[model samples]
Target: MNYLISALIITLIIPIWGLLIYFLNKLLYILLSKISSEKVAMTVVNYLTIPGVIHHELSHAALALLTGAIVTEFKPFWPDKTSGSLGHVNFSTRGSLFTRCLQCTFTSTAPVILGTLSSILLFAYAANNTVPFYILVPMIYLIFSIIIHASMSFADVKIMLKGIWALFIAAYIICLYFQIDFLNVIRLHLIAQL
Candidate 1:
């Protein structure tokens, strides 16, 4: 069925998008390092993706707080070579098992959710062609910066995997509440694209 195919395509898009971002990040770092010292390359890349890093860390902290976790430490843009992280958030894991799982899963995945929403809004605005050239230029850069860092870090993904069941349940509940036929929606969107 077309709906089945569309669902399959939708499922494939997430991993493909993540891989594309990962490769692009690695390629940028490699190219920059070839032209300068490794440290300099790292710094340049960090600065370039600063907006996304800030957004990513803030999303984690915000969602952690919202989910009844106490944020202990928050670093928006501290590039740690040892940890290989651009930023991080530490939160207290004091809650029931289900609550803790939900907190971890939601907090870890917040960046991708918020970043994707932001990118969609930005793209819609750009598509309208109403903004001035000066504003549009920075908007494009911001969109690129946000997207490049939207993918989860390894640690985030690990945390998410530990509580992925919570995410699935939450997603299902949301779809139910919204009266969404997930496969049908995907099928319609795919047809619209074509």
Candidate 2:
């Protein structure tokens, strides 16, 4: 009986996550997107991509908190309302190095991998679950995120990959120090460039 409840919850949890991802992706696609040259698209995609990164980062923080990792806060990325190309967000952590690493991986990879995984899980549930919404929601999120994160001819994949790695490393360090801030760092660097 315990096994049955555990299995049921496990099945429900992932599909629910998938559902959230699906709606989130759609929301991002609608708002923070436009037609641009490959160069411009690439530039924008890095920092001001969409609302999806919020989903990714929040997922990481939530998972960490669940596993007893100390998480101070997290923020989502949105258009500067001034311009695109600014990925400003607020987050902090206070956890052991190991827990922080786990948190980092979760936060960094959630949009790309778990976001993808969430979609896959939904599709799987759609194959067997009675609630078609279970599958539909996440499928949408997966598609939108994949598109937003994708390198438009405007941006090169090599550059994007480097940014991803940098974000991953930053997540770890952020988790280690509760006050370390990447959002302010990013904003300052952008200001300098301008």
Candidate 3:
């Protein structure tokens, strides 16, 4: 029962954590704008999150290409305060509506998926290996940083909603059903590896 509760908590927190990070970024951006120019605030945010932004845009581009979408514009670090977009990938969707919607949803949500996978690998690696204290600290920091930036921005979510929210929901449900103890599996795997 405790294990089940723990898994439930972990499952709930994953999405909520991403959303909290997204909203926190927005709030910080707004507050910073009051103290300085919007561009400066946005620049600061972008500068601080260069690694995440690069990963985000790369994932977007990769998924876009995989979906056969033409990525017309790709900006890894061009923050736009006016548009409230930290970085963007402009791609044209084609094919039937379902295919277009799936492509759009996948492209927009790739960052979170990839970031989570990266974070999991880092954690698992750290668990499986012995490292010096200093190195371990930085490794832990990197994992946290990846998680912090793993969430899609409001713009990304909006694009996803415009695509096919139902499809995404159904996919999520299917994944949930098959991986009800996903967190526990990760925990167990780490334990075994350690």
| Alpha-carbon lDDT, every model | 0.76, 0.46, 0.72
Highest TM-score: give the candidate number. 1
Q: What TM-score does each of the candidates earn?
A: 0.77, 0.38, 0.64
Model 1: lDDT of residue 165:
63
Show model 2 residue runs off by greater than 4 Å. Answer: 1-51, 81-90, 127-142, 146-194
Q: What digit string (tens of lDDT, one per residue) describes model 2 on residues 64-96?
A: 565455656455554464654223323343466
Better of 2 and 3 by TM-score: 3
Any idea what lDDT model 2 has?
0.46
**Winner on lDDT (1 vs 2):** 1
Write down the lDDT that model 1 would get: 0.76
List model 1 lDDT by residue over 1-194, tens digit each. Answer: 44344434543454346546667877888998998878888776678769988987888898899999899999998888797888889987668787888888778777776777888899998998789999999999888888877776667778876766665566556555665565777679999999
Q: Once model 2 is optimally superposed onto the true structure by TM-score, how far is the C-alpha of residue 78 displaced, in angstroms?
A: 2.7
